[model samples]
Target: MVDADQTFVIVGGGLAGAKAAETLRAEGFTGRVILICDERDHPYERPALSKGYLLGKEERDSLFVHEPAWYARHDIELHLGQTVAAIDRAARTVRFGEDGTVVRYDKLLLATGAEPRRLDVPGTDLAGVHHLRRLTHAERLRGVLAALGRDNGHLVVAGAGWIGLEVAAAAREYGAEVTVVEPAPTPLHGVLGPELGELFTELHREHGVRLHFGVRLTEIVGQDGAVLAARTDDGEEHPAHSVLVAIGAAPRTALAEAAGLELADPAHGGGIAVDERLRTSDPDIHAAGDVASFPHALFGTRLRVEHWANALNGGPAAARAMLGRDVVHDRVPYFFTDQYDLGMEYSGWAPPGSYDEVVIRGDAGRREFIAFWVRQGRVLAGMNVNVWDVTDTVQRLIRSRAQVDTEALADPHVPLDSLVP
Candidate 1:
């Protein structure tokens, strides 16, 4: 029999929620664990959706984070296709959709995650304009890709972020002419910084993907209920048969906000406020993944990190905390993106206006390089492009908070581990 007192309710069936449930069970909580997901399907991996999955390189079954039989064997009650209408913090209950069923919980984890930001421009609602976030979105894009004739189709992608670049690469692989429009001066400028962003721009260009930087899109033009082109702020129209809006993502925190949970400052966008323990204002409720903005031990500020590592790690951390374990979330932020034939891995935390020097290792021209961000002679962040082993060295350097010799770090002759203190 399940322990009634250990009933844990998890909202949202993404990586965070599913992992949290798994962690709870692994921690010997043989209790009632209920996972509520608004989506009809079981929790699945999302990172591949924008890359291999979109290109039809991977099957839908491979995207699942956990198999149905696994959940059943673990005794996890999955409530799929059920919307959480509201959360009653005081009563420790969650109300669902029109059915008005209320489920009470001793502890609750809100892994609501985030939704892809959509283009609000004209013709955005047209048939060929889409945003890549969910399985449904990928299915639609796959359908469109399959229906295209042998002639190369024009695909206009809004925003030059990782998703946009990945989709562009996939589209190009399918013999489609891809155009990426970004208001920023360079692709991934907001995340990768200018020098690295320039490298990414070159990589995309090398793949025959047209990139329009420092250009704001004014509207998405469609004809006869199908997207035809995207109009820029410069009064230029780029013809396109399909448009993928991969601008960014917004945290899904409406239910959390309505439940009277304190939210993060809007100046930092719509992320939910949480402590180092991933506990929200209400002690009974906790949050993880993209929806959460928690204090960074290294950066000395709060941040909302939207990365696969964060979702995978943060979920279990929150679950452990909910199970009366006192644990501080202090992992250095890490993420990676694959574009064309290049793979980029980044590690550590970089506080704004703090890095004093950036040391590059290996040759950028040869499609292999690692850049280290240093502040006060201490390594703060590192980016490795096409060099997988650099990630191991970077992780250790970040954890040790070591000061690296710039000369050794910048020298291609020296191995990355030699720079680690």
Candidate 2:
């Protein structure tokens, strides 16, 4: 074991990095831990940025993972407003910014996280076109929405991922006229399969939001340096006062690549390659969160998930591995989104093209239901819409790897609790 004074350096002060620092302390490692964040604030929650926070229903302080005092109380060094310029793995140090302040680490965690993927289409640089990845971006969008007087404000959300839908819901709640444009046939088609995808599409449309599917955006039209509309590939121009680009995120792996770490397949989408224990090819450097791709037991392929739960759970798992603890990092991945009076929760892993049966447990038409994606008599994944209790039972079933009865799962008369392992 290394000396207690051995320094631990964590890059990126987002959810994963912050949690890793907290976990290191919790694991009784009284080491010299330094958290380097590009932003000025202490780590704050990002999920709420597109939802309650953006709507002004939540304060900035409320989003903080821990208060500014907590970091001090824990005695964790906070290096704010410093971007890691390069990682010198051979030298066991990281150079930050132009001044090149070097931080030496015995062990390093690359929780560099991800950045919003921008569209290369014309007029993307328009003033009103924005991406909601960071708190600042959300703040800017919120300010514009509030200034425009949400009521009857025309807002076009280009992309139909969780971020896009959540932002669209918030804009609608403020009485904005919202239009969601998605290139896919259904929103969340890549994540949620067809049956659940159809449910989400219907859910958004029911809430008075216009939904356009199977159409690609060609350009963001501008007037006087501000966005005016979005031109589609189908030769359609949809007018809007503001536009949000929520086309998903690309892993922030530049520093890792610079350090000569093995990168995962771009088809797996530019995440760092790591073993089950979250150890990167370098072994001394570990990666987790959206930046790391590991083999999934359920999917049987290397996968990367950009969910809040992964950062929450995986950060601690990596810390344990660093401490030489035998910890299996397998758990049901979970994510939730609140949109249009619907609380959507999903858990477990969905193998691609493996769900042969979809069993609905509640009324989809009533905007409340749990849909189970079953393959080979086992529950691979499940989607819950306003039926959160079912998620607990699904987690248990997934952990136990239990065979689920299709008829019982589909039967609304049966309690989901009855299916628990």
Candidate 3:
């Protein structure tokens, strides 16, 4: 039933967009495929921007999702360095670039992704103040970190989120002085809650990273168009040669908004509203990755996930749904972080009010343990720190939604799989 003359257009050239195009071809869709990207570089994953690539452990060529010739070889039209200005739902066309070239599509996929939130204080435009969301930003920050290391320069990181902590670790590895400022009581306060958050605070302290909690960055003071210090609400000035604003990110839904597409409520981490099949209000248009907010059946809530794994799996799920195949994106929310000698993987959603108690297995003092957030005896989420090959067990515990005894869950000798039945 393939429509050979139909055209499928994908906007954004990140992991989700590229993967969706590849999925279409792999599924034997002989239709016209077009992909548009605002960045000049080929599609790439974003994890390396804060991990190996930033630390100089990964080569530049490893970032791209495909080689430059891959698209042409597969007969996929790729338009790089082009931004879509408008989306015409009625005409099924998208206008982009200075010349306003319009492309028609029978089916459309929006993988626009998200943009990093900017610091709203004075001197943010000054040199040495950085934000890491794109490859260009990471490339510049990598060199800045090396120079800072050689000069023993001080780096003031605003917000102790994943990006901030990862960059801080990379900076420490490069021998640069790092100071992280967070308004919360601990690092990763929103994600891990205070209980496990304290563990991260101790980890960074052991690695010589200065942490200032219960304080927000008020202003960035600069001299000669370069950052000099970061002023905090706690009435302290931290001397800084460079500043990093790793606050958070907002989904890029401007095009969807202008086109009058239904969007999720802002309180629910707003993005383009989609069903379980990733289809928008207009059936011809679908969305995936960070920009798509869909109802999660297991969590019984609408969630917009911005992690790398979501993009890795959501793209193909959306592609199959586009091809008239039944698809439901119900993967458990997952993410990971590496700081210093510790590596951790988190599965399931356990926001502050959702989980009543947290259970820990193994020893926290040794930084080798698994933590589970439980609500009324049902496991809601789990995190394994410095634990190996247990992701499957952790995710199974979450998906099973089985009531587990607190003592047994906390016992390291107890097999996790045995608790499910």
Candidate 4:
């Protein structure tokens, strides 16, 4: 039984850490809870930063996970704008803040999350260069988008991933010209493969966004400390008043590394290696969210997911395991994206080469369809675009691992639930 004498410390103030703290209290744990965050703001969700909030459709206050007063009411020690300098595993203590104040813990949860990958090319430090990973970045970008639209300025975006595409859509809505540069043949080539990635290319092109496929931004050219244009490897220069780097993120695991915790292989996307219970090699410590790489029994591979759904669910699962409850962090990978008029939700993992074929069930041109990635007649992953209320059925099909007929899977008349058997 967890007693009041025990103190649980949580590092990193992202969604995962915030939810873990909430779960501990809801589970009737009387122990002391300390939540430490390097950011001054309360724990908030990141999806809004790229989607609604960035587009000005959502207010700033909506980003927070909970009301500011909730932490105080729950007797949780909320330390904002503080950093954990080091973790002394043997002493069960963490040296935090600039003063090096030490705080001991019976159990510790690291939800350090990930940081945006930086652009290494010259002129990246120019006035209009931007990267969106935090609320502050979103706030600045939000204003920049409006100003660009008013001035009819051009915005060059690097990468055509979710962040890049979403921001491209937002920039277009703001009436700013957009030029996206990607090394892949199509947008989202890594996640959706060439087939589905082509659809995104058409979507953005229809919205008046220029896409430079099969090329990368070699350098961001600038004049007078302000962005002037983005030079591509093809010897083409796309005029730009601003540049947004959306190349993806790297998991933050420095603390876990310094503490001597076992880490996952780099080939598998380096992260703190954890078991089914989200517990690290050191039994007293656990890692969740983007920082954790756990073996997925269903997929039969160790995976690290940076999606919002993982953090939303993983935190609670980690907390349950901390309370000595039977828990397995084997939830299927899931993610969603909103770009222009198209909205999509993808469940299960079927990165390129994992599936032998993609079975589509609706009109592709209309942008209302369900695509399933199947291998050996078993569904490996599924994505529904502009389709609603079918996520549960799709996930059930993935978990069942049952042989599904490609003909029936692609038939709109065939109900998805009936194919499970």
TM-score of each predicted structure versus truth: 0.96, 0.96, 0.98, 0.99
Candidate 1 lDDT at 46 equals 87
For candidate 4, write residues 211-263 as lDDT tens digits.
99888788998889999989998999999999999998899999999899999
Model 1, 1-421: lDDT tens digits are: 2364668999999999999999999989987999999999899988888878988889999998898899999999999999899998888899989599999998999999999887767788888888888998888887676554246688999999888888888888777888899999898887767767899888888888899988877888887898788999888899899988888999999999999899998666568899999999998789999999999877777889888899999999999999889888878889887777888889987644668877888888887888888888788888988987667778888777777778877888877777566
For lDDT, candidate 1 versus 3, the one ahead is 3
The C-alpha local distance difference test score for the whole of candidate 3 amounts to 0.93
Q: What tens-digit string does per-residue lDDT give for candidate 2 at 257-307?
A: 988999999887669999899999998899989898987776677878899
Residue range with the least summed lDDT across 10 consecutive positions in model 4? 213-222
Q: How large an RMSD does model 4 have?
A: 0.8
lDDT of 2 at 209: 88
lDDT of 3 by residue, 1-421 (tens): 5588999999989999999999999999999999999999999999989999999999999999999999999999999999999999999999995689999989999999999898888889998899998999999999999999999999999989999999999999999999999998899898889998999889888889999999989999998998899999989999999999999999999999999999999988999999999999999999999999999989999999999999999999999999999899999999998888899999999987889999999998898999999999999999999997888988888888888999999999989888886
lDDT of candidate 4 at residue 82, scale 0 to 100: 95
Error of 2 at 203 (Å): 1.9
Residue-pair clashes per candidate, as listed? Answer: 0, 0, 0, 0
